[model samples]
Target: MAPFPYLAWVAASTVLVPFASRSETAKLARADVPRSRAREKLGFATGQRDATQPLVWFHAASVGESLSVLALITRIGAALPDTQFLITSGTATSADLIARRMPPRCQHQFAPLDAPGPLRRFLKHWCPDAAIFVESELWPQMLRRTHASGARMALVNARLSTDSVKRWQQMPATARYMLDVFDLILTQNDAMAETIVSLGAPPARVARGINLKSMADPLPVDHAALAEAQTALRNRPVWIASSTHQGEEQSVLKAHQRLLRRWPDLCLILAPRHPARGQEVADLITEAGMSHSRRSAGDAPAGQVFLADTLGELGTWYALSDIVFLGGSLRPIGGHNPFEVAHSGATVLSGTHVTNFAETFSGMEELGAARFVSDAADLAEKVEALFSDTQGREMACAAALEFAQQQTDKLDEIAARLITTLELSA
Candidate 1:
């Protein structure tokens, strides 16, 4: 609103975008985009569109954010049967996931680079009637351009971490300018709503919304792969340390080594957060004198460790194991979503530093759905007990499943509010 102060940043980014696009093209063979997609990300399908139809655009930062919006998108699509939807995300992985799951009348594209030139091209081509941004993807150029074009905009499931709030607080003018662009702001929690209002979002337009990430469908599974992994393991006690970061994998492997003493036939499925680091994790397994197989190399569980390093098959591994220790928590990485693992029917385990989903984990703990471990030794102890205690594991699994299912009512409430905000029922 106050003459968005990002012109200089946009000007510089516009000049450098071409070189950045080339660098990104080189990472096309890689799973996640390197430094997010640049100019090349503006490409969208030339699908036929009725000129009379209203088009709503949804932009999400990456795979998790993209998937979180699917249920909301589906509900909105069902209500506005004549409207078309364009879903844009910043990563190739999100694009791939959206491609497989996007409902009818919806399409996926890599989000435009948040530079003036690319943003203008993207706005001109799509000329979206309304925009909904998921999570914290606050690209100044994109938001300003969309607002200037007179499109209705909303920020849904808005979450601003303490770190992000501190960063925004340092640039009050810029933060206010960005916050004022949204016609509506639905935050992930009341605290987030308060933060948004404090940062200059109109208080009348901001309110607490349930975390849509919790409403995401369980990650999709390849049934054949799941069955194969299940048969290969032959009913042996299996557990997964999913979405592990660099240093976190070492801890997981060490825990597996310790657990092996008590359960010789135990299977540890290690899934790194970044699949590109598959080789690095495999080397760690080798150095520890453990036989391992790499999933990216098309290897199965012919050894003690099954390296689930391939992209987009977490559902299979979640299905293959009853006990799952979510990894990013072990290090200070803020942890990955354990609810998703729970949705896939696994009892969840996490490390102590789960700041990312502290509230969610706290609720789960109260419900007896998840366990916390302080270190590798604690992790090994808890994992072994879960494997041995069938009753305890089953009860946790049931509680987690119940918690995931309860998220739908929240989705329904958000969908109703979104319809009102977008004036879709008009």
Candidate 2:
């Protein structure tokens, strides 16, 4: 019933224009979009789009967002028998992660390209009864097409950045269009709730919901690998520079250099968060002239920076370290999940850009379970100081781990809300 902003988004989906010139044979040889399209094609359910069984769709943007929804999916699958799930995401990495974790009744699909044609094909075929988008995935076509199909929509774990709010406020026409799509918006914190209201979503439609990460169980690690890392780290002090961004790696290198001076055998484990960027980080380490080893490349040389360059091994890296610096915060990505660092017994240090994870970080800090650094230099200083005194490091981690353990209950509570809210509609 409201004016929509579907034209610009519709025009932008010319993503397939280049494919028009290439031969199908050539496309297949290059593993091109058509080849990727085949993968997308198989996930479609044409004739049965509106079959008797209820279809609930969950969409997330990437690996982090997809993983966050896992706990909620597991609960939904268990409680609702005969209910099928159609999960969609925009990125390849998100789809891959979901592939590994798909439940019995759930299916993973490439979200229909945001263009009008493909999105129409997608909604016309899938016709999901309820759409659940995680953490602010406000695609106009997906929301409008599905809603127009008479399906209900809700944004679980919704978030809106302050800058994004101000930006959207300037485009009230567009903001109002997308805001109306999310009938219920469960935000992660008060700051996020305020941002949502500013973005034209009414106060009544939004509420602060518990963060999924605080409710996340750490990814399990292989015992053998865990033991090997533990043995290599035996009696030697170690700390993690986790999910570190591009510029932050050089800072960690200098910090490792600084801390190594005090605790001579100190080994710094650098997890760049993006394993694909291992080479870039490796180059930074080399430019800084610190010898390093890639986790993907057999064992890291002793005294060399351990490039924990593999996905799914972050837990192992966190577990083996005594101190943890969850990255993304040092230079304003607002830090990675501190709750994860807290789950493992490690002294957690993050940067001040924690507006995103304010509640989780706040609880950890209140419990004396975590600390913050105002700058990279301060992060370096804190990492060095924590490693210098074993007693202080242990105290910090003990408090953090205990606090993290207390958060397991939040998952069930939030999952319950998702159930009640989604099942309430037509």
Candidate 3:
């Protein structure tokens, strides 16, 4: 029997799911999400599943979570040639990106809502042999129904905050019941492993695993675009502030102002985390009195500031410079992935609030591949030091590249572990 809280949740969701699904579908459609894909959340699948071949279902919450597992899925597919994969994520952004870069034999879909009707139709159609839930996506009904269907399940790259741990600890029976659905729970580090265990996951089932984000395939670089940008810059010293959030852009613009004093022709490629804010960010650059060009407008990197307000071109921007400042850390939004920057052969500079990728940043810092900046002044200072010291900058880039390379070597090991734990092998 399930706990009272779980039972109550099921009862309420059963009554409210229809109305909720309609409301959500309308909201997503208004956001320009295609009506066809939005309806998938209401238990409609866009494709057929092959019942003869074993299928592995991976559910991730958003873009980062979905992309992190692509390499692992490739490795697993190589080992089990007869296996097909189904990846489900909740966001349209993730859906579009995954469609472009999906691994062979894999299909992407919008995850069904965690209600009886959606789950029933989803499970009945897909009939996944094994399910892998990534990070903190512990949808109660999804887990319960999948487990009840006799499909082996594992939670990979698991992480939880102190507050979440406290909340789970307060409902110990519910926590245990939910966690027991997983045959294995692989956490990002030892601390996360301990945290999950404390939440009632079987100690034997919990193990420390590498951060999957570290193993993401390098972002695809458009060679023609890279060449054109490099030629336009004509040897100007460049640094990029990639994935900048709202509050962080002001500091980045200030730092760019400071850099202009020493290196008059230095170009700053500012890519915001959300490109929809291009006009807003352009206003900030203008207020800072910097001549700027917008990438979405097809303007070249001709100004002191280049606003890269486009999607899927981060690789080309990273290739423009060796000094990269990753944002999202300046505020409490956690941090963007540094491995992507490192993989592009650049030195990483970030702020101090990177709780999401704490272990990842610690490793890079230890390798002398990444540095932490406090404010605009500190950011300018660090960027200046890297620009002036050629040897030091090269060493940092080399160290970062080395660190990025080391992560892929662990993918096969992780893939094998998942295979054994989930019994996904033919």
Highest TM-score: give the candidate number: 3
* Total clashes in model 1, counting residue pairs 3 or more apart in sequence or in different chains: 0
> lDDT by residue for model 2 over 56-85, one digit each (tens)?
888887778887887677777777777788
Task: Rank the candidate models, highest lDDT first.
Answer: 3, 1, 2
lDDT of each: 0.82, 0.74, 0.92
Largest lDDT belongs to which candidate? 3
Q: What is candidate 3's lDDT per residue for 222-247, written digit by digit as tens?
A: 99999999999999989999999998
TM-score of each: 0.91, 0.84, 0.97
Q: Distance from true position, residue 271, model 3, in Å?
A: 0.5
What TM-score does structure 2 among the candidates reach?
0.84
Report model 1's TM-score to 2 decimal places.
0.91
